[model samples]
Target: MISVYHYMTIAAILFAMGTYGVLTRKNAIVIFMCIELMLNSVNLTFIALSRHLNNMDGQIFVFFVMTVAAAEAAVGLALMISFFRNRESIDVEEIDLLKW
Candidate 1:
C-alpha cells in the first residue's frame, strides 16, 4: 500500500538531484531545467500532503506555484535567448551582461 511517506521520499530525492544539478552545472539551460525539477518536486509534495490531510489548501498553493513557475520559465528562456544572441554562449561563468 503506497502512502504519503513514499511520495514524500520520492519528492525529496528529486529535489536533491535538482539542487545538485543546479549547483554543479554551468550551462544556463541546464540550470533552468534543474530549477523546474525542483519546482515539480515541491508540487508533488503539496499534492501528497493535500491528499493526506483531505484539504484543499496545499492543492491551491500548488496551483499558484505552477502559475509562477510558468511565468518564470517564459522570462528565463527569453533572457537566455537574448544572452545567447549577444554572447553566442550560455555558459554561466562567461556571462557578463553588465560589463562592456
Candidate 2:
C-alpha cells in the first residue's frame, strides 16, 4: 500500500529535478517553469502530510501556497514578457535591464 513516505519521496525527487533545471537552464521561461515545479512538489508534500496526520492545517496551507503561486506566475510572466519585448530574447545571461 502507498504511504506518506511514498508521496514524500516522489515530492523530493520532483523538487530535486526542479532545482536542477533552475540551476542549469539559461532560458527565463524554463527557469520559471522549474520554479513552478518546485512549488508543486511542496504542495504534494503538504497534502500527503495532512492526510497522514488527519489534520486540515497542511491542506489549508496548500491553498495559500497555490494562491501565491498563481500570483507569482502572473507577475513573473508579465516581467518575462516585458523583458522579452525589451531585449528580444529571454536568455538569462543577457538580462541587464537593471544595469547602469
- Candidates in order, TM-scores: namely 0.93, 0.94
Clash total of candidate 1: 0
Tell me model 2's lDDT, rounded to 2 decimals.
0.97
lDDT, residue 70, model 1: 96
Task: Judge candidate 1 at residue 97 and give its lDDT.
Answer: 55
lDDT of 2 by residue, 1-100 (tens): 9999999999999999999999999999999999999999999999999999999999999999999999999999999999889889999999765887
Q: lDDT values of the candidates?
A: 0.97, 0.97
Among all windows of 10 consecutive residues in model 1, the one with the lowest summed lDDT is: 91-100
Which parts of model 1 are misplaced by more than 4 Å?
A: 96-100
Question: What is the per-residue lDDT of model 1 for residues 1-100, given as tens digits with 9 covering 90 to 100?
Answer: 9999999999999999999999999999999999999999999999999999999999999999999999999999999999999989999999655677
